[model samples]
Target: MKHRTPRGFKRIPAWMFHSRLPVDAETRLITSYLLTSGSANHPTVSELSDALCMDAKTVRRNVYKLEELGLLKVIRRAK
Candidate 1:
């Protein structure tokens, strides 16, 4: 599935920046990294893990949190 940016926003996957709840520096840092270094060229989790020194699974989980907050969308593949 293609993850297109929502209307009136950069394609940058930055949900933490404009979150309703306050986000910590670590989350903001990760969001910034994703916005700059990430591209459709690679998986978001992979890029985030490398930049934040976190496991890809952890990145996936946090991104889901962003999705749940209506800040972004998560695309799922057919099993």
Candidate 2:
């Protein structure tokens, strides 16, 4: 299946790479992975990292950025 890049994520700026806005590449990547992980109803860092081929540490760090910008909810991690 051909995968289309999600909307609102085209031509993101290098300075905004860490922004929570959908236009940011890292943000878009993490968010996109979460959106497709069947975890939108209960998003988790590990699942998103697995889907994105990123490390948990990076996922955790970026998740913090997303949460700080009010783009994502960061509930406590599951045991």
Candidate 3:
């Protein structure tokens, strides 16, 4: 299991800070959080909202944007 804490040191790619992608600040923030914070494929939206201090709806929207760019895949867990 990934050893995650409420806050901890995370390795982030330098490219993220200097990428040429036409992503907004929020998209970049979401990408950074996922790269450093989320599970391999299970970054919770609630966790993202709490950490980033943004609304869940906003989080979902940015996530969708990231998905559309083909940066990551969203695998919904079975209910």
Better of 1 and 3 by TM-score: 3
Against the unseen true structure, what C-alpha lDDT does each candidate score? 0.53, 0.59, 0.65
Q: What is candidate 1's lDDT per residue for 1-79, written digit by digit as tens?
A: 9755434333433533566565555444544444444344345688668867888887777776656654443222100
Residue-level lDDT tens digits of model 3 in 17-79 = 456666776776776667665454566889889988999999999888777766654222210
Residue 52 C-alpha lDDT in model 1: 71
For each of the candidates, the C-alpha root-mean-square deviation to the true structure, in angstroms, is 9.7, 8.0, 7.8
lDDT of 2 by residue, 18-60 (tens): 4435544566677555544443565677767776788899888
lDDT of 2 at 19: 44
Segments in model 1 whose C-alpha atoms lie over 4 Å from true places = 1-25, 38-42, 73-79
TM-score of 3: 0.61
After the best TM-score superposition of candidate 3, give how far the Cα of residue 7 lies from its true spot, in angstroms: 11
Ranking by TM-score: 3, 2, 1
Question: TM-scores of all models?
Answer: 0.47, 0.54, 0.61
Give the Cα error of residue 70 in candidate 2, in Å: 0.6
The whole-model C-alpha lDDT of candidate 3 against the native structure comes to 0.65
